[model samples]
Every structure is written in C-alpha cells, then in structure tokens.
Target: MALKQYMKTLSCPPGCNLLLDTSRFDNANSKLVDVLVNLKRIGQVSVPNTDENYAKIRQIIGNTINDPSVNKDLIIAAIMKTDAIRKRRGNSARNRSGLGDVFGGMDTGMDYGMDYEQYSKEKVTNKDFQANFTVDIEKEEKIFGDKSFGETLKDAEKLGAANNDITSIFPTAKTEEKSFEESCPKTDIHCAYVAYMENYANSLLNFKDFTQFDGKWMIARDKIAAALLHLKSSYKGKEVMQPNLDNFKNVCRKFVFLCGTKANRERSELVKSAIFIASEARADKDDLEIHLTDLFGEVKASPTISKDAAVQNRMLGADYADSVRITGSWRSLGIPSRVNGAESAIDYIREDNDVHSMHAAWHQINNQREPRDRKRERFFYFHNHMLLRIATERASNGLPAVQPMSNDVLHMEFSTEYNIRPENDPEGILDDYNSPPKTCRLTRNTQETLRNELRDLVRYKGLGMERFGHHCEQNYHADLHNLLMKDCDVGMLGYFAVSARPPIFYRIHSEINRVWHDFYSNQRYRRQDIYPPYGLTIRGITLHSRCGRVNQAETFWEKLGTHYKLNHQNFIFRIRLYNWRRLREKVIVRIFMGPQNARLENYFEMDRFVHQLDGNRLSEIRRYDKDSSFVFVKDQNDCGWPYHLMLPKGGDKRPIKYRLLVFVNDVHDQRVNVGTHPSLNNPMCGSNRQNMQNAGLELVDDRRDYGFPTNRRWTFNPVPIVNNRDRYFGYMSSIVNIVHTGEETDFCNQAYFR
Candidate 1:
C-alpha cells in the first residue's frame, strides 16, 4: 500500500525531470550518465520511454529529497526489479562502446569505464560551462551595508515606522534590482542567499559537481540516508518540520558534520542563501508564486497562482514547504521590502547566540551592577512578561494559555568555551574535543537558573507585577512553587524569549505540571457545596467531518521536505449543553478525548468553552466554533493533541478506540474576569483569524497556568456522570485508523482551516 501510494506520487523518475528524456542519457557527459544510473539504482524505476516516466522520476526524486529516509533495501529491490526488466528486454545498450556512448550496463557495481579526467577537462571549462556561481560578499556589503541585513530591517520596528518607511533604513530598496539568478543585493539578498543554499544542500538533485559524480555523491547519499533514518527511528516531534531555513541549515549542518564533508566555501555561500529562501518560502502562503532556478540551473520552477486543486497539488504539495521556501519569496516576485527578514525582535534575541548569552548573564556575579547587566536583565524580564502576556492574552482570547514549551523538551543551554589542556593523555583519545579543550559544554544549572529568573518575573517582586495582581495565585505552597518553577529541567520556557519549538516546550511544561499536580493533589477543598440546582448537563454529542457525521478517521504520516509528520483532517464536534437554570448563567465547559480506562488526569483536554446560554436553552456548539471548541493546530501544538500522536497506534488488524468526554463546572467562573471581552471569556480556548496569520511565531494571547481549568484543585460531581472521578459528566466512543502513509482525504483544507 505504501509503495502504491508512493508510485502514484511519481510523475517521472525522481531527479529525472530535469533531463526530461532517457535519450538525454546518450551523451558524452559521464556525470549525467552517472546521475541517470544513480537514479535507477536508488529509485528502482525503469528508464522512461515517455513523459510519464519523467513525472515518475521527478516525483521519486522529490520524495527522496523530502524523505531521505528511503530504505536502502527498498532501493536495492527497485534496482533489482529494473535490472530484471532490462534483462528481459535484452542488453542492447550494455553492448555500446566509446566515450560518447550510454553506460555499458545497468550493473550497480560497474564503473562504466569512462575517462573522468578527460570528461572534466572537456566539460568544466569556462566556455563549455553555462554559468558561473559565486558569492560576491564584497559587492553585497557595498550595496546593503556591512550591518547584518536582519538588523537593518529591524530598525523600522524600533523607530515605530510603517511598512513604507523601510526605505529610510534600506535605501537599496529603491535601486534597480537584479533577476532571480543574479548576485545578492540589498533588496534581493534573502532570495539570492536561499537559492544559493538550497542549490548547495540539494546538490544531489543536479549532479553539477563532476568531481563528486561517483564516490562522494554515494557517500553523501548514504550518510543522508543514515541521518534521516536515525532522526525518524528516534522520532520525537522536538525537531521542527516547518521548513524554516534555519531548521534546514541545522539539518544540513548536521549531515555535513556527520558525513565528514567540509562544504566548500563557495558551497557554504549557496547553503546560506538556501536557508534564507527556504525559511521565507515556508512562512508565506502556498499559492504565492515565484520563479527560481535549482542548483543545476537545468530545472526552472515557476508555479502558477491557481485555485485548481489538481494543478495546485501537482505543483506544490509534493514537497510544499520545501518547494515554496526555495522557489517562492518576495524577492522572487521582484518586491524589495524585507518581508523575509522581519522576524520578531524577541525571536532574534532568543536565536542569536551572543544575544542569548549576554541576556543569560542575569545570575552571573561580575556584571551584577553594570548598566549593560541591567539592560540585559530588562531585556530578559521584558520577554518574560511578553510570554506571560501572550499566554495571558491567549487565555483571554479563548486559546490554550499554557506556555507552548510545556510538552517534553528540556532546554539546556550550551556554550563553546576554551580551556588549556592538562597535558594528561595528549593523544586525544578521551574526547571529540575541538583543539585542546574548546568544547561545547552545557551551562551549569542552565534550566534552573533561567527558571528562577522566570519565577521572579512571575512573582510579586518581579517586573510588571501589577498586571498580574493577586490573580497569579497558583495552588502550590510557596516553597514548592519555588522548587517546581525554578527547576532547571524547563529549558525554552525558562528562557521564554528564545527559540522554543512547541513539542519539547510542552515536555518541560508537563514536568512542571507534574510537580504542581503533586502539591495540588495533597490539598483539600474545605468548602464543598453540593448545589444540584446549578448542575450542568451535556445534552448530546456528535462527531463531524466536512463530508458529514463520521465515527472513524485516519491519521497518516505525510512528508514535508526532509521530514515526515502525521497529518490530521479537522474533525469537528457538535456538542449540545443544557443550563438547567431559568436565569442566564455563565459556565465553563471542558472537553476531553482519552482512553475509556484512563484517569481524568490522563484525559486529553481537547477544547474548553465559556458560554452564557439563553435562559434554559440548549446551546449547540459546532466543531469549527473557535469560541466553543476549535483552536487551530499548527506544525507544532494541537491545543491538546500532539499531531504525531493524534491517532493511537493500532495494528493492521484493528483501529484504536477512544472515549470523548465532556464536563461542566462552576469552579472556573470566579477565575473569569467580568466585562472582559466576550471573546476573551473562554480565554485561550479560541483564537482569532489574526492569530492564524501569525501562526509561524506561534503567538497566543493568554496569561494562565499551563494546565488551566483541569489544573484547579477543586472537584465536583455532575449529573449523567461517566468517570468515577469526583467531577464527571458524559463520554462517547470513537475509533480511527493509524497508517504510515496516506494523503489528506478529510474535508479539512486550506479554506476550512482559514
């Protein structure tokens, strides 16, 4: 089934789309032939007789590029199958001779007996070469200024300037701009850089490097394969799959280091551009179009802006983010504004190494009273407030107010420091230390230290404490709160302004939650008033998909560039509630999806709503209702469900079963601020359309505990109870198929999501 799905995706052999014809293989260029051979070897597709083969090869190549995790055995099997087909057809091509001929045979082990030195002399000359690729940093610096391009763009924000004022800081925006393939300029730097880097990283696609046509290419391929396998086998969603240029650079950086290949200085230049381009592309809309050349200068991608689903999917979805990030950019469209460089100031502060450490020196002694130290502290403190502020605002916006980093990641800070060797064991058998002792060592108490600072930021004596007031009361005792909040295990959350990908962020937050749970479980609710008159009841529940009602759905692993992530179709719920009161009353509704046998604590909180039903009316909330049930799931957090684990792992024999539960309580009522925006009533439960626009930043508007309503220490029993827990309401059962490979077939598309 996986193979069939994969075959269906192929329009031509992977990497053969540039060549277009198998007869193109009848050439003097051994590099081209080697590429053809490698394609058949790795992809196992027969040489094409028609355009369909080109599509198939192109798709296969794309799949391999997006998922370097393709199994070697599978490739070997495909090659063997292709070889069998060739043998059945007779070895006509294999009998060819002379330097100008096609490969002698399809044998994987054969060298095809070509004089590579002669081939290089003939093909690599200036006259023979179609173009020359080089980075002119001097020209770039002269045109754009020596300052970091990102820093220059950021000046507009600092000056409180509008979008049009960008020219004041960057005069080059007004100058004549070059085409896509031209050298980097102030206006086109991001696109040029990304193009270069993408070309460098995906050098395998073009086979442009004649010197590496044989051995190094194969080695690089194997190393990438191994790296991808390692990443996927130990799959944790911690490493982001957003196709951000930095993420791509990081992945490529890892591969380059692990494969023992020091990228040529020229190649590194291209790699840098690739990173920038990929990032900008992923952040933009899918339909946004651009024209750009791949590294080989052979494949030109010009996606048409169209609404046709078939055309769009064929052109974009194969490696959507990957393709767009490289081919689509503001520069690609001839726009000069710094749309690609406009990352939040907070993001820059967190990601820049020097800035991160300078800000991290809050606990250090030397500069305890220095003005710079104070500034650093202010910076850190400001972001701490910002994170809590966003969380607070998100809570007010009816979205999840939990620090996104709460899932499973531990953000230990590390820095490369130099130390003199002790002169013991000079052979260097003890470590992979660079030089003597300059090594990337973990900062001592990195998490704990940051956590303490964060805790201080949240406390009464911290900066901007007045905004939180007494509402900052967590149920934990002061000492335990200090202990849990200051624990060093919280990496990204501890350093709130820094880069915190959601998965690991949630992990650290979960640990903190566990600590809080320990303290909360020990406390007792002294005043338990049984107000049966205020009893809230769930009237009925139904599962929904775009097509209509459905009880089962499938979640599958979808490839996104070099990574695989589980894709889920939006499943809606139509939940009915009865106030059972004659007077209008505001109540909190909690929804959970979990195993029937699991404890309420383990139940996944899917959605929450704060509703004021009309006097004694049954309020019906739909699945797409952000105010009542929906919070847009991004590449990272899914409100409550982690995308990778959206569906339970069921075998080929059966689907995983789960129970959906709904409960209502008045405990959250006192916590709600009256006259707050009616939209903020479900605080961090539902997000606005604006929030979706800035989803890349993963920003939210809420200031609340990571686990809000459920985190409360109070308990109450409701009518029509299902779980034995003190507060229970009702539940429904459902099942789903969990597969390794499948396309998004659900009604949820960009339109529904938007």
Candidate 2:
C-alpha cells in the first residue's frame, strides 16, 4: 500500500486532461511532456533549469513526432526513480545540527518528538513493512479509455489504496548525472577551467546573496574559453598561456571583491576563505605556466647587448658626447618598489641582513635611484621588502599571494556612488574607511613623503607597537578618534588602523619581529630582567584555568564551526609581587606569553596593569581574568579576527606547553604619553576595529603600544630566577600546559553543575 501511495505521489494531481484519455494524443513523447510539465508545476519533480534532464526532456517533447515504440510510462517511472535517489543522497549528506549529526542517523528519536526514556525502554525490533505494487498499463488504458481526467485520477487513487507494493511500475532508483561538468564533457584545459568556475558557482547555491553573481560567473567562464580559443590561433608557445592565465586570475580577483570590503565580517570571512581557495587554484596554474615557459623559449628572439654606443666614454670623470650622461632608468616592481624602494625613490642603508636586502638588490639591478633620507628610507625599505617577501613566498608556495580581492587590474564602482553619511551610515559603508586605500601611481615626491611617514611609524619606542602607534597611536586623542571613527581612508595600514584584515599585516609584523630577533640574537644574549637598583621582584607566577591548576600534558577542545572558532577553556594568571620600596610607589604589571623555545616576536601580549602600593608590603597578590586589560575573546556582538588563535591548538597525545612571563615597570620612569583614541582602550582585539570605531566605540583596551609592557627595548640588567629555569627579556617565567576542552579529568566542567 505504501509503494502504491509512493507511485501515486509521482503522478500528476486531479484535473489533468492527460490522465483522462491518452489515446487522443497520438505522439507518446508529447503525452509524456504534458504529464511532466504538470508534475513539475505541482512540486512533485524538482528539475532546475540548469539540469541536463530538464533540457533533455524539453528537447525530446519539442522535437519528437510519431515514436510508436517509445513507452511514455517507462520514462515517467525513470524520472520518479531519479528524483527519489537525489533526495536520499542529499538527506544523507546534509548536516542538520552544528554538532555534526543531521538527525542522529535514525528515523525517529528525541529530535523528532519521541520520548527518549520510553523509546529506549521499548524493545528494538526490525518490522517487515515492505510492500510491492504492480502497474498494468494495458489494463489501465483499456479501463480508462473514455473516462474524464478527474474520474481517472480517482480510480488511480483507489488502486493505490488497494495495492501494497508497486515495484513493477516505479522502477529502481539510480544515480543521476546532475553536475554541469559531467554534462559539458571537460576534454581540455579550457573546458576544465570553465568546469571549475561552474563548480565554484554551484557550491555557492546555499548562499542567497551570491545568486546574482552565479549567472555572471557562467558567462565569464564561457568568455574565458572563447578568448583562449581565439588566442590559440595567433599566439605561439607559452605566450598564449600567459594571457589566458592572467585573464583567469583577473576573473577570480573580480569575483573575490564580492567577498571583501567593509561588508559583514562573518559572511565576508566565509567568502574570503572560498575566494582564497579559488585564487590558490589560479596560482597553481601559474606554476604550470612557469613550467611551460621553461619548456618553450621566449615568443620573440632575444636582444643582444650593444657595444658601439658608449665606447668613447671610458673615463669615469670625463664628460662624453651625451654630456650629462645621467643614464637614468625607472621601473615598477609592483607595490614593493612603488611604495618603499627605488621606483618610489626610497632607499635603505642595510644595518643587518634581513629579507629587505634581496629587494635592495632588485632595485639596484632595475637601475632605480635610492631615496635621500637615509634612516627614513632604510625603515620603509626594510618593512616594504619584508611585506613583499611574504607575498612572494606565498605565491611561490602556491598560496593566495594577497587579500582575496587584491588585484589592481579589475576595479569596479557602484553605478551610484556609495556615500558614508555619519548620520545614517554609521558603519561607513560608502567611504569604506575600514578598507585599505585604493591608490593609483604615486609621484616620486609623494613616495618620498610616504617613506618618511613609514620611517616615523617604525621609530616608535617598541618594535611591536611601531605600526600601531603611527596608524592609531601617537596621534592626539581628538585626531586619533577622528581617524578611527570617521568614514575616511586614513584608517588603513599605510594610512590607518585597519591592518589586520589584509594579509600584509602579518608579513609586516613578521619583519618587525625579525628586527627584534636580530636585536636579541646579536646585541642581547641574556633574556632575563635585571634590576638591582629598584627593590622589586616577581615573587612567583601561577597559571589558573577554570578547574584549578594547569599542568603539562593537558588537552583542550578548540570550538570549530562553519564560520567561527572559540577555545573551550579560558585561563587567568595569578602573579605574586614583592615591593622593596619602603615609601609609596607604583609599578606596571607587564605580562606576556611565548613559545618555550622561541624569540620575543612569537610572544603574545597578555595583560598590562599599573599597581600602586603604600610603605613596604613584603608581598602583594594580583589575580587576572579574561576581563583583564589585554585579553580579546570572540562574542556574539564583537568580531575579533584571529582572537580564537590566541589559544594555541591542542594535541590529543600531549598537552601544549607555553611560557608565561611577568615583568614589572616603574610607573614613574616608564610613563610615556602615548596619545590616545577610544580604539586604544578596548580589550578585544579583532579586524572589526573600524566597525567599532565607526560606531564610536573603543577598539583596543590599553593606552600604550599594542604590546605595551614588553614592547619597549629590553636593555635592563637580567634578573636571576630563584629556581633554575628558562628566562627571557627580564621577565620571570613559568611553564604551563593548556588542557584539552571538555575532558573528563578537567574540573572546569563541574562549573556547569555549580
């Protein structure tokens, strides 16, 4: 009876003329199409316009004339079977719950309103509920020869009610070819590229906002294929490959813009990850291009060096026919040279070797002149080269080289310009002040000015704070607030505080860290704080989790989701401080976290607080929690980028060991009037700084540089640890392990009950 009911469900509903008298329609193909169209309209069959079956059915019905042998009933049965198979496939794959199970893999359970206790108590037994119904097409045609469609449908319903199984009529379900790539036949690279784009578009079907761009992607894919086909005729060797590859990259970059911008951060991050994967695919093609280029020589004959022109100008000091002989040359090497190197007339005098030297050599080879300001040029050059090296390395390693939509070639503007009105558009959507600046070629003089500005940024007291200071810090409170809150371009890295969104942020920091590493490796050997002059000491350090004490070999669960992550456990620090000062005095509680074996660059800023004390107290206890001055954890309202990364990934085998350092600074001497903005006072660190700033909220919590307590140059005499243990930068250390989340041994779980 159930099988008959399933078969009845596949057929058209009442008031269908095709079911009344099929003999009137001589063509079986036409009759089948009529039934299919009715079935499609009523939601029985879900055939999207893009489906090959939909097209095939349309073609057969529109073109077929008198096909005597073809059975329309069999075709209908096949369609029904295909639809069921697809439904089953999708149901099995879909993840209904964020917990990873769709429906607990059962027909009925607690999720579907069944009482868990009663259902569990009942004996689980397999019931033989199978049924089979047979359809007699000849008998049906004869019986309903002259019946009306409504009468025929009623008879079929009655037949369905009478039968138990309908295996003979429905046919077996089989895997249908639903993908466009399968239908299109990808025989070559062009077809493969087109298929890749189509697959990407198909993957975004779940996302409704991207629907408008789906058709555009198909059009672009076809356009790319056409362009490649046309170029194949005229271009020779690898030359043709270059243009097509570039075109594909351009298309990918164009699509990437749909993701980036001051758009919603959560959605944007998802789009970005997808675009990054697509861009990486294109970058892989670049490697193929390189291989092909190596296989084939240049498209044109190579040029030879000329000897006759400058033969008479052998003397270095003597003037030649071309008197000024200023043989000047200029070249562009992407933003690297344009921003901080020779193309921009900015140069750096190498202090110690880093990634920048490679770029300096590149500039020299290109015959570009260096900037006049030595110290300023060196700072810009080092940082510029450092960032450039990161991008180049990512490219070489087959990763996305820049932000998802960083291509300069394909730029688009809304037909109606978006205006950021502070009154109505508080998020600054129009001006996109949170976004990186869109700049054209900078003049040589402007480049020099930018260089000087960059130099000014890095010269700030602390290495880690240099970039933050120039962009958001150091500025007067009013000016900094304006820069952070307003819908202007001044908030971008080269210009503002919105550095974290772009990939260059990490690279620039890596360079800054490299500088610190060099300073520590060569200049300073001992990494402990030594202060014999001041009567202050780090009594002891303790790491506290929600449970009690954090020990080595602990495991913690990293909260993972489709678009977000959070560490299951949060920790607090308990620091014991001893003040040797007999009179009233204040000290800065500087805290940091680092790899047990690495340099200070890898160190994360934990917290910084100013502590005041009266006449000689031997010891003072200070407890720190997530509410402290430096911790930034993700929440429903705030978008903290990489805040989840603050907690290191845990291993199943052994607990992750980390070093905790606590050092103190005298409030009197260490005080620097780091100019402030509301951004300088927020505890949560994330990419949505501009979002908060535009809303006129604080972005960062601390007043000094981002890495305040340990940010300054560590030149103080080393402090001896009471026990034999590792030390760095004059800070007392404790080795602790972050336990895995939701573990049975973890006492933190008991908090839920309490």
Candidate 3:
C-alpha cells in the first residue's frame, strides 16, 4: 500500500504518461498493485525519500517501519488490498487472468494449459537428448575470454595507483599494477558480441517460464546451462586468474540466462568465432576482412571443393566463368542414402558429353525419356528440381550440415521464375510441380505401384487416361514417367506423390531421406517431444487428390469411381473442391469422408465469395478461408513450397508427416479390356501383379513391389557392464552388434531425450 502511495504522490513525466488519463484513473484498482511491484524491482530499497520518490509512503508507513523488520509477502499483500491507494493509479486492459505473467512478465504461474505432468512423465534423459544440440564445455570456455593478457596488465597498472585491497582474487595483478585503458578489452569480441547472442543465451532458462519440461526444449536449455556453469566455475577456480576474466564470464552467463533457454551455443558463439578468424587474419597479415557469399546460376556443375576448401578457394579467388553447379554433390548428409545416392547420381551425371543432362538431371536419369512424350521428362525435371531445391534449402537452414567440410556442386537444372504460385498459371487451375525447390527420392516399388494404378485406369475406364493424352487399345500413352522423384542410394523412409493422374499414388521407400528439407531434417534430428532423436521410420503415404476444374476431356464417371477404393483404415477427414463454371461466383470448401472417388458425397461446407459483383473489401483472404486455397482439391499440387505443412492431424497432433490427397472424378478403370502387351504406341509399359489390388487397377510385375528398408538393431553386440552401470548415449535393445541387459539404474539428466 505504501509503495503504491509513494508512486502516485511522485509526479509522473510531463508527456508519454499513457496510464493516468480519465478513462485510465476510472479503472485504477487494477493498476496500483502492478505499479508498486514494478517500482520496487528497479531500486528504492526503503520508504525513505520525501521530495524524491516514496516520500508520502514513508509518512504513512513510518509508524509500521519503526516497529520491526517487515517481510515482502505482507507488504505485497497489504499493497494489493489498498483501496484508497488504488484509486490514485490507473490503466487496466489485460489480455486475460492467468495468461499474463505475475512478476517481471515471466509466465511461471500459468501457461497454455499444457499437460505438464504428462510431459514430465514422457521425458527421456540428457544422453538420449544429445542429438538435440552441441554442448561442449571446451566451446563454452570462451566466456572467460576478454581482452588480451597484456591489455589487462595495463589496466591493472592504473588501478594499482589507487588504494587497493591487499586480499583480492587477483592479488598478483594488483601488486604488479595496470592502467585503465590497458585493463580494458582490446581485440576482445566478448563484450562486443554479448548483445548479439543474448536472445539465444536467455532461452536456456526456459524452465523459469515453462513448467512443463518437454524433453527436447528442456535438454537444449539444460545442456547450454551446464556448459555455461562449467565455464564460470573454471574461471572462478583459477588461482592465478585475472579478476576481469571472472567478472566477464559471470556477466556473460547472466545475460545469456536472461534471454530464453531454448537457444544453442553454436549460434551465440558464431559472431565471436568469426572475430577469432579476424584475429587470425591480423596475425597472418592477410586481408582483415570477411565477406558473406551469395549463390546464383545453375549449380549442378558446381566447382568441386570441400566446404573449407571452398572457403580457401574464395580467399585465393577463382573465376567460375561459364559454369553450372549444384550446391552439393549430394542431397543427404551422412546417412546411407545420402552417401550412396550422392555417388550414384555423381557417376550418372559426370559422364562426358552429358551437356543436355545438365538441364534436367532428375527425370531423364531416373526413369524413361522421350522427346515427343506429352508429360515430358523436361517438364517433370524442372518442376521436381524446384521441389528438390526448396526441400534442401529448408533442410540446410534448420539442421546443421552433415557434410560441413564438403563442397556442394552447382545445380545443372534451372527453372524460369522458379515458383509454384497460382497467379502465374495460364490456366487458373494448378498443375503438377514442373520445378520445385527440392525433390524426394522414391522406392522402385512405390514408383511401380503408381504405374500399375495408372495402367489399370487406362485399360478399364480409358476415358480418364485419354484426358491425360494416353490410350491403351491403339497403344499411344501420355509420355508417362514417375512424378517428381530423384533416385538415391540412401533413399527416403517414405515419399508419395499423390497426384490424381494415374497410378502415381503410393510411394513407400526405405532409408532416412525426405523431399522437403524440413522433413528431411526431421528424419535426421528433430526435437520430437516423445521419442529420443535418432531415426524416423515412415510407414507409407496415402496419396489422395481430386480435379477441381472438372473440365477433364475424358470423364468416365462410373468405372473410375469403383477404382478409387482405399482399404487402408486411416482414411478420414477427406475434402474435395470443384470450380463450377456455371455457378455464380463463390468461394467454397467442401468436406467428405468414405470412398475418395464417391460420386454422391455430401458438400459439408461452402461459402459464397462474391457478395456484390466484386468488392475491394473482400479482396484480401485469411488462412481460415479454405475455399480459394490449393489444398482440399485433387491436385498435382502435392508440392510443399515456401513452407512444408503437415497433413491434417485432426486437432492436436504431431502432424501427419506423410501426405494424403483426396480426389474426385474418374482417372481410372477403362471400360474396355486391352491386352497387356507391347502395342504400337505403348513402347515402355509393364504390368504389375493383381494380388496387390489397390482400387481397380491391375498391378504389373514392375519394380514398385518391394518392402521399405529398416535400420536393423539386432546385429549390435551387448554392452556388458560388470558393475551394473548404464552408459550415457547407450543403445542396448536390438542394437546391431549390441546386446541388451535390462537394468534398473538412476539417471541425473533422465528428463532429456537422446
């Protein structure tokens, strides 16, 4: 109460006083307590000033102050109950009770109703969470680093002139003497880079705000804290240490904890790390400068050099005149597929006189190639290359580089205005990705599966296949190739191209890889809250789609409908959209379940877009307006651009990592039976087995019927421990060469994930 009284009695600043107006003072009850708490936090220990602050509060509470020592709890509670003091203060509009933080705006009291108890139960430990961030004590030792030892001695000389304490931490330095300017940091980036890394450093104290220590977010914070503490302790215990270094390390650690606990030391240390490079340059008498490089032009023929070698090459200077390079020779990092695929692709593309191959590397190299084909490989190459690039970029940004020391090759393929934005299309309706930023590798089985589905559609219905410019009886087929997929030795866990076009549906691959960089990174090292970070095994992808325009030249409504059945029980939350030309202008989103190709499905939800013929106010659209969006329609639009969004996980979910498309119209089951043989037009055709009947398509004995690869853990030998101690970062159960000894042991960092 006295704190509030002191605050009000003190005159506020002339202007910029937003809280004390008429409307504000009317709601003063909410403001008094908040103001009192803030004032006590900055300074002013006792209610002792009159003309200054706390003058009135002293007079009012003088009697109480003289009696005895008062605790903060009584003071805070008494202040909040002060009605007379409350009316003097103002400003009330809070977002919600429990939502806002109570002290210093740190949300410790309440959060978004997260199940803390459940989260804590699920936490694994520090060793399991090691894959999350790099926490090395040697790295954090930089906290004690400040000015050169020589500069510190000069500052000591200046301080030595004054009366100094005989018994100090740096007694030897005090005796030796130093100057002020000399003691100050010189060529020391510690202070200069503190603010740069503060936000990241503070994230380590995430526990102060969030009650729930979800393993990933928690370990990432604790390991950093551990690293900082180790640095601090080392600095303090140095018997012959500089006092300046100890103070610097302490302050640096404090500021870091103030920001957020979820930041990594690698990012925080980068600026200082660069400064070290600059220091090295000064020592070497080289150019005292560093320049960030920009990348452009085709990258498939990228100049061959390691990352470090690339940096050195830049330092030495090289003219990449008339050259094309792909940023990296490989898409993946250390995984099996990455290593294998990189080697395979390199050999294929490196063949001499493959000049035309540079333009489109993925399609022609992976599958069939024909210049006259309608669904041209070049078109597919450009589109898929775009997907590959985008996915790779996202992956590169989020996760650390596995091939940190390797040089990336230049990309040979190029796309004009490389984007899939709907505005640039000749047809307002979208099409398959011609050039995506990144591409995913598919299994031979998945590729063949799609082919069979398309073949069956072409053979039985004939109509849907006809629209795609393909025929079965006469033998002419659309120049068909597997959709946007790159071949790799280290393949993906699962990648499905869910186009409503032919048998281009299910894609279940083996290995740890992804098209979108986001998932690609996820497959490697994601901060998954439940399991320890290691490997991701994708089961399969259910590709569903629907043609929105409904302008298919060959519409076989009946037989096509029967062929679209999915026996997989995970089918729900299906929606389809169609742009009815005859209908008045309207934006609509429809939801449906059951068969993906059901003819008589109910339109769950739709909203008319145009109130008047056109209005400026209605031009802008929010994400909630699902009608105009490319999703909710059968599409070749199964590409993840600017962002890789997770398929619907119902309400609260870890995102359906795989994609699923729900389509309408008949792109399947030909009415006439055509013999499965080499026809006049159909030169490259294969029939798959019929037992694996998905929809009405007759599967051919092609390459798409293989099981996905698994990381065999049973081959590892048992980690025998005579003393019943569990090792950190241990993999006992089902390890390839490691045997399991089920043991009960206590763990310190058990709350984090490995």
User: How does each model score on TM-score?
Assistant: 0.34, 0.31, 0.20
Give candidate 3 misplaced runs (Cα > 4 Å): 1-55, 59-77, 80-85, 88-305, 308-581, 585-754
Q: Model 2 TM-score?
A: 0.31
- Runs in model 1 with CA error above 4 Å? 1-510, 524-535, 546-550, 558-564, 578-583, 616-619, 625-654, 666-709, 712-720, 724-741, 746-754
Candidate 1 vs candidate 2: the lDDT winner is 2
lDDT against the true structure, per candidate, is: 0.32, 0.32, 0.23
Which lDDT tens digits does candidate 2 get at residues 698-730? Answer: 322223333433334445432243222423222
The lDDT, on a scale of 0 to 1, for candidate 2 is 0.32
Model 3: lDDT of residue 254: 24
Per-residue accuracy of model 1 over 8-98 as CA lDDT, tens digit each: 3433233321112223211212332233334332345346443344335433433442233432212322332333233344432323231
Of candidates 3 and 1, the better by TM-score: 1
Q: Backbone clashes per model, in order?
A: 63, 30, 118
Q: Candidate 3 on 1-754: residue-level lDDT in tens?
A: 5453443433331121111122332234234444542334423455321233432442344234222233222232224233123322332112232221322233333322122232234212222210111111111221122444355445433333222331221122224333312332211222222332344444544433221112233244333333332222221221111112232332333232322232433333222222222222121112212111100011122112234433443455632221122122222111111112222232211111121122222211112221133232223223332323323222322432122100121122211112223332323222423433333344456456545644454334423322322232112111122222233211110111112111111121100011111111223211121121122111111222121211100101011111110011111122222222222232211111111221111111111111111222122222222332212111111111111111111111111111121111111132212122211011111111111121244322211101100101112221221111223212111100110111111221211111
- Give the worst 10-residue stretch by lDDT in candidate 1: 293-302
Q: On a 0 to 1 TM-score scale, where does candidate 3 land against the true structure?
A: 0.20
**Residues forming the 10-long window of minimal summed lDDT in candidate 3:** 551-560
Q: Following a full C-alpha superposition, what root-mean-square deviation does model 2 have from the true structure?
A: 24.9
Ranking by lDDT: 2, 1, 3
